[model samples]
Target: MTQTLLPATSTESSSRPVVAVTGADGFIGSHLTEELVHAGYRVRAMAIYTSQGSYGWLDHVAPEVMQHVEVQLGDVRDAGSVRALMRGAQTVYHLAALIAIPYSYVAPRSYVETNITGTLNVLEAARDLGTARVVHTSTSEVYGTARTVPIHESHPLQGQSPYSATKIGADKLAESYFLSFGLPVVTLRPFNTYGPRQSARAVIPTIISQVAAGQRVIRLGDLRPTRDFNFVADTARAFRAVGEAGPEVLGRTLNAGSGREITVGDTVKLIGQVMGADLRVEQEDIRLRPEGSEVMRLLADHSELQALTGWAPQLTLEEGLRRTATWFTDPANLARYRVGEYTI
Candidate 1:
């Protein structure tokens, strides 16, 4: 059965193009929803339905922004709900997925359902409804530990973890839809995105939240892996860039990053520097990935995204870290996270 969608809250939004976003309640999705609103588009945001009526991060958005967003309670895993979300939408940004790496280890089947099957639902809905554009989300983890520095779009995909494997499957499915059905899809693969509203499961937030909670010795997993950490704002813009770009980007996979790399240890130190804390690291066995599953390095070659959409990361690592620290240090924001507890 088809689910009925709520009408736009404001009459002014009726004139704007309808852009549907799955997972608008998530970290990057919330930022992207706000970005789309700021760009004068009417947003249809899909938050996973729950009895508690929680809209995740969308519930915390400013009232003014909320006025332009229509929240639909649905799941990407359900075809009917996904089709309902996409109906009458000009563009669909598919971001819903189970993304925690450690959790993937515990429940690989959930990852398959949400990431792979959920993507299938999005593609089918878009194809059936004739949506103009579908901005499908991909992760740099598909490349695993980089075989070469500055991983490009053409770099070989290596799924070293269950999470990465599911994403790889999803990415391939997106490719097949574009090639097989001529669906207008652009895969925007973002490197490690970090900033405000990030869960403590992530390295940057983990370090920040611990230090904010007055912990001098930070507990973390292996600190030797390197990453190209893109700020959430820049990542949100990249999604819009691809979603709104012309057909030149159709069926193409693009990378979004700052083109800079920093090791986990150095990143921790940098966070300490930005927060004015002299922090120490204590490795925890539980936090460590299986020996072979750990991605030792990741650096993105985002030139293709720039050449195609003129999008480049605008924030420096230190500046982004500082901004993140500012948000995580806030009493209310810090209170949301269980500091000192290892999050999967």
Candidate 2:
């Protein structure tokens, strides 16, 4: 029997929602879950089921936050499990997916299963359960190498790699569900989101971990590529804003970004400045993505979201980097990652 959960709307006056987050164990998902909880929401977290019962990065968080959450072990790929988890919940943030582009090359089928089909399960559950709002997650990679500066939601989606292709498929499916079934859903396309709890698989964490551990030579690839990075808190706030926006912003995809772009090379130098370390960056051939697969540039057009919700990122790049460096420097936190070899 499924327990009855309150609608997110019913709890609005309390500055909270009885919300559920899929992929609450992963980086961005974990952070979003925490944000929702901190906002006074009754959060039920859906972590991927495993024999090890690992909560992923969520395990590293302060225990106080973890104590308040109701943990439901399930996999998004399983339609029945997803439906059960959505029981009585009003708002759903679907962030569970296989996201490594490099790994997708070896396991394209897993990408399709988790990214597309898994999203399908969440949408179906939300549609049937009458969830008040569903915020679907999308990545900047879906836009591919941008043909224009500051890419907007209107820009054509180019599937440059199998990973992006699957996400495009997932985003379109979410749109179709919203239009065809009247399922209240909003698509959130986030530029690179970085902060504490991010894994070494991501470039931000990879760079921070290597630099913090006293690496005399930092290994990197394709430093010329520019990326727009939004702090995880800002990204999480965007999700909350979409939920609070109600029906006015339904069935639309909005970008969450700082509206600023910087090259990877420049980011490294800035981090060095923040960390007060003088280190040489060396190009590693193994770290480079295939020519066609790399997204050479990404700058976000956040005007749409800003005009609608009146929210903007508050964290400066330096402050964000300093916080991230601090998290990685702590031996307790840094041990979560193996600094010797590359993750993805």
Candidate 3:
């Protein structure tokens, strides 16, 4: 069943609870790692093993933040590695998965191996190790096309693409673990999280990077589709909120979003406004999702999260876009992106 671990806050290093995070080297994972460290938790971050010894985005975090983080090179797909990562952790924030929607179409098997199997490894390890809590990451894509406006956690899951399908599988596994074994788990479904350090695979970064690279004509897909974008910082805070909240959130799934919706076309216009650019649009067939696979709408109803954890979106779309644009416009940061190339 459930085991209660040490309290989240403590002044002494010996008293600080250890938290493990999978996929801590990627976009949201890296941000969440920094967030946990700032919240005074000792973080054991699992970065995918690579010969180059790259920690992905974790290498870019401030040295002060890195001081509190222990980067462990491992793969979530391997149960042994996942177990080692969670050995003594009080809580595990599982964010590792194959996240690129377009690539999932070409390599669906890889998504299953990494996303579905990887999640199983985390759940099994957490269950066996008696970890106090598991914060499993979910995405808005799982609630494809939003059968109703302001999608809630109860929205029917529609796997519009291979990536979403695998995430749905992972989410269900997490649910099964909580129900079958009373393993404490909370699934956090975030809608369109975007900000600095986000890769070009996401829409917000795609538009911002193109504009930052001086492209007057922005190439995008399905301008009609609308999304409820949440800033990365807000998303990171939501993870912490649920991770640290009392047992009321156990065995629950919560939505985190701005509760505001904007069409891709309008989003581009807004980013243009934020960057002080006069932009034009060029729809690209290659960039578009397959006809039936596209998720045309997603708007989040995060009221449940607010009621449970007092968490709410703090940055407006414009303010968030401004901050994202500022970071992308910086030459050093902008150089990291291949602006003209389609990343999918």
Candidate 4:
């Protein structure tokens, strides 16, 4: 299913430290893999092992870029598979996890297993292999509905959803390893990341695909809830920046975001504006999260990242949406998505 999903090879890396990404088949992971290759590192794009041998978004990238990296099929849950992939891999990027919030409610245990266990496996492998850098992926959901505006790393975490809870567990596990064993690791907490190749299960893709596909009534859950949207390209750069930040900032968590907030209602309007229409949002009852489970708002504090590494967001929400809308509007691309349906 990931065929034409992620780009799959490398051309310009030799003798540089290899950066292995566990979920290279995923949206953010695939983009980050590409950026790592462009940054002149030997990149090992490891997708979960499956019989079909699908490469996901890696396949969407031009073959010329594809020639610049190595693709490895493996699963994060399988420790041996993960360890073997970690060999000679100087840096490890662990983005392999089931992240759908709604699905987590139905199968909370799977979230705990995959998100928590998989992370433990990554830490263990990185520890033994002595991986020089480990940049763990953390989501803004871990902060739940923020109790304060522009939530920072010191902000308290609340597991408003099972998905958030599991991620919190995984993050805590990462922190423990860093503190106890001194693993050269940094955690990046990215706010709402939106871009091409994102699954429809996410709000941005769900809304953009539907609107771009000419849907008059764009279905959505809560419009009042706001999020700090970060373009995927910028978020990918954050991963590289975290790794290059080194030990002084080691064991620290940085927020990769635009530091700007937009309500879902306003975001829908923005998408409509990009699509050249003022589409109406219809509340899809089924699309709504459980009353108490939904995160009402999320605004990120990105100051630490800038002060620490001089890394800042480059794309505005409007620019990112225009690009994302353009991609989803392409017939060849739109056909890749089930735009007309409510994606659970």
Model 3: lDDT equals: 0.92
Worst lDDT 10-window in candidate 2:
1-10
Once fitted onto the true fold, the runs of candidate 1 whose alpha carbons sit more than 4 angstroms away are 1-9
A best-first ranking of the candidates according to their lDDT comes to: 1, 3, 4, 2
* Tens-digit lDDT string for candidate 4 (1-344): 12232443333345656888888889999889878877777778887766777888887866645666688888788898889878898889889999989888789998888899999999998998889988899999999888998898999999999899999999999999999999888999999898999999998999988887778798888899999999999999898888888577788889988989999999988888878987988887888888888899899899999888889999989999999998898899989888768664
Of candidate 4, the 10-residue stretch with the lowest lDDT total is: 1-10
- Report every candidate's CA lDDT: 0.94, 0.85, 0.92, 0.86
Which is the better candidate, 1 or 3, if ranked by TM-score? 1
Judged by lDDT, which candidate is best?
1
Segments in model 3 whose C-alpha atoms lie over 4 Å from true places: 1-15
Q: In terms of TM-score, how similar is model 1 to the real structure?
A: 0.97
What does candidate 1's lDDT look like per residue over 174-205, in tens digits? Answer: 99999999999999999999999999899999
Better of 1 and 4 by TM-score: 1
* True-vs-predicted CA distance for residue 110, candidate 1, Å: 0.6
RMSD of each: 4.5, 4.9, 4.6, 3.4
lDDT of 3 by residue, 1-344 (tens): 11223433335544668999999999999989888877888899999999999999999988767767889999999999999999999999999998999999999999999999999999988888999999999999999998998798889999999999999999999999999999999999999999999989899999999998999999888899999999999999999999999999999999999999999999988988888899999988899999999999899999999999999998999999988999999999999999968998
Rank list by TM-score: 1, 3, 4, 2
Candidate 2 residue runs with Cα over 4 Å from true position: 1-16
lDDT of 2 by residue, 1-344 (tens): 11233334433524445788899888888888777766677677888887998877677655656655667888999998888778878889899999988899888999999999999999988877888888999999999999998899998899989999999999999999988988899998999999988878788888889887888578888899999988888888898888778577898999989888999989888888988988678888888899989999999998888888887888878888988899889998888788847787
Candidate 1 lDDT (Cα, 0 to 1): 0.94
Clashing pairs in 2: none
